[model samples]
Target: MKTDPKQTLYGMSVQELQEAVKAIGLPAFRGVQLGDWIYKKNVLEWTEIKNFSKADIEKLAANYDLRSLDGSEASFSKGLESTKGLFKARDGHFLESVLISQRDRQTVCLSTQMGCKMACSFCASGKAKFLRNLTAGEIVEQVAWIQRKTEKRISNIVFMGMGEPLDNFDATMKAIEILIADWGFQLGGRRVTVSTSGITPKIIEFVERVDGRVRLSVSLHSSKPDVRDELMPINRRYNIDNLIQTLTEVHSKLKREITFEYTLIENINDSEEEARGVVKISLPLNAKVNLIPYNPIREMAAVYKTPSKERIERFTKILMDAGIHVTLRKTAGREIDAACGQLRLDREAVSAAGEPRTKNHEPREPAS
Candidate 1:
């Protein structure tokens, strides 16, 4: 497929913009000016850049796109203000990002890839065939688009949406630099998180790259190696023992808090023994456990069910009794199929069936 020609200026760093401007026959300082306009001023149109002459503006416009969420496809949850943006890549495949609103904070969950190859059995994202890695610009644009749409400041960003962020290490790191740079979003390094399904080598590289400034979350659904290996195929390559050891070394060096995301699936890994296993692994590293009750996806509903309230509470108690900091994460945008890849899957279904697509804001039954 033919790709889109116009390059995006929104995600470029000051140095990168300078290089780009030099390539376009403009003075190097012009690139810094472009970076300020796009990142700080949030300018969408080339004409809005007043510093450049009309001819120069036209020339820059011809080779670059100042795109944001202004005209992109979006859907909002009916019951809540949660919105999902469907960004069409240059190759015409759609990637989804979600904006979740709660209290005063707006958190945008960004996707690093069109689809996931991790193949975690319980995640809807892994069910979709792997497409391609999203560029640094593409990943950064998701936040820019959501911020423009909601008219609210995005306080936190989580790489917990559709893909294994560590798998696309270079682009993901570049996006992080863009997010935390003073000239870019200026978000605090601690407020931004990159969650991985235990890609051991990348985890080590991530810690070294950011020097443990950016928060890290691991999707450690189960503590048992056998159970984790079955649920997350990546475990076959990097098992719990190796993952925990790496995390231990990184944490000891940086003393940054590591979060382990545990999705409690009933009859799978929700038993008291499993909770004790989590406690054992987490206590050694002083990790915070974010317990997520499994969100049922149609493909895995028959085999997986969310742990009951009692089970969830009991699990939390086990960790707390052991001095482990734990929080039960509230499932947001369930009514809108907001879980990982649900929105993208829904869009694909609609297209395959030749149905008219519309913005759906009403609360509906949860995905089967």
Candidate 2:
């Protein structure tokens, strides 16, 4: 088997890191030191490994190269203080990552896959269909690239950017292990969140693997099967009831609060009745509802619209009145086409047109 040298620092367990050092003819103890530099110090170049002998450092560099993203193009949110980088992978594939600077910490949302297969009606990621699953190194490199450019430590990471995380379970979990491992990123488990679109078997697998360490966010758009099937095609395969059952099982086994991401769309699934249904579904579980007003996309305009502010308030009131914890996530980067896949699509159009293409700021219809 050809060993993957670019094994993501975000995906390796401590023992795995030790194994990597051993492969390079270094003492196992060197894994701990390397881990400290990778995670704690956040170093990339082998020369940064201060304790390693010059010959050993040169050997390590020659044998293995750390995966890092080279930002080909970038767009920043002048209004919200966030930047999205269009990174060119070594393989010439393009992936996107966002760095959002908030009051205290800067968080980078990383993509686990190049394109998405889920085909959520409101999301822009799957517009090009599923391309490929990102390697653990590619996923981690998004963070490293953004960190290097901004010179800010990423306080949190969300697997909500592109691809269904649970669909890429092994790489996803390995990335989480790297983030939390002492030899890796050394981040607290709670600071990392993995979002999935109701992949039940993987939820069970996650429960078995994580054991209440990392957080989970499930995209629960609508409680009705018909509505969900129309919005998210994945619902047709997994359905809502089975998904809820699996979430319940995972919660029971792990004893953690899972977040339910409810993207409210106008006239489709944002009624008081639906809000009531949301409460009924969530009342039984230890979960919080994150209500995101639909991020309007030009391609998806005919299919979806944001509910009136009054309607959103009414919907939120229903959840809060029902005593269910809820939050209305303010849509960030409205100035730029900040939706997950918008940046790359614009870049593609520009390249194809062979000119500077103007961005359509007006929200368009969602993909069907």
Best by lDDT: 1
Q: Across residues 181-224, which tens digit of lDDT does each residue of candidate 1 receive?
A: 98788899988999999998998888889986789999999989
Reference-based lDDT, each prediction: 0.83, 0.79
Best by TM-score, which number?
1
User: Residue 77: error of model 1 in Å?
Assistant: 3.2
Global fold similarity of model 2 (TM-score): 0.89
List where candidate 2 sits over 4 angstroms from the true fold: 1-14, 46-49, 349-368
Q: Quickly count the clashes in candidate 1.
A: 1
RMSD in angstroms between candidate 2 and the native structure over all alpha carbons: 4.7
* TM-score per candidate: 0.92, 0.89
